[model samples]
Target: MSEGKVANSNRAEQREQLSVAATATDGVQVLNPAGEIDHHTGDALRHALDVALTAHPRVVVDLGGVTFMDSSGINVLIAAHHALTQAGGWLRLAAPTDTVMRTLQIVGVDAVIDCHDTLRQALAD
Candidate 1:
């Protein structure tokens, strides 16, 4: 492959890996994030959580589309979780990919936060 073509392909992949959304259902907010969560996008994720929390007290973060997660991403989540808890609200994680889950486990965060297998279960609880 040509060098230019390779660079374009890499850029496309990175673009495709960046996405985040917040949806509300039954008074619960669901943050559906897609892509690799790293230092570059952790701020965006944190902002999304802040916006969601403003409207909905209960939040369920759908991590099914998250392909990768780093320490910065985990810090954003932990901060959100703490903020929600202080406000008498709840923040839960759902459908984390193997890589993301492993990262959480390695960091010992799984024991501190509530994680569910699906968004439905997370919201229902």
Candidate 2:
């Protein structure tokens, strides 16, 4: 490939690495977020939620690929959860990594939100 083409491809890959990608499956929107969801990437995660909410009332954020999460990440989830609830829908977390799960528990968010072991379980109810 040409040098410019290779550079463009690399840039695209980097962009993909920075944010989560979501898809709809069986009336549930499954968001597979990646990378670190700190202040910089939190907006991306929120945007993903916004987009997902538009299509499906029920949204499941599959955090299996998330390597790190901070307060901003927690805030994003909380806000989305509230928004979904206000709309008479539900936003749930699925397969959160140990770190993410611990953070939620520590912040008392675990009790406030619904979390499941898998997307299938999240969607079942």
- TM-score of every prediction relative to native: 0.90, 0.83
Residue 68's lDDT within candidate 1 is 87
Model 1 clash pairs are none
TM-score of 2: 0.83
Q: Candidate 1 residues 1-125, lDDT tens each?
A: 69999999998679546588888999889999998888888887999999988998788999999988899999999999999998888899998988899999999888888998888888888
Q: Candidate 1 lDDT (Cα, whole model)?
A: 0.89
Residue runs of model 2 more than 4 Å from their true location after superposition: 1-17
Best by lDDT: 1
- Indicate the worst ten consecutive residues by lDDT in candidate 2: 11-20
Query: Which residue pairs does candidate 2 place in steric collision?
Result: none
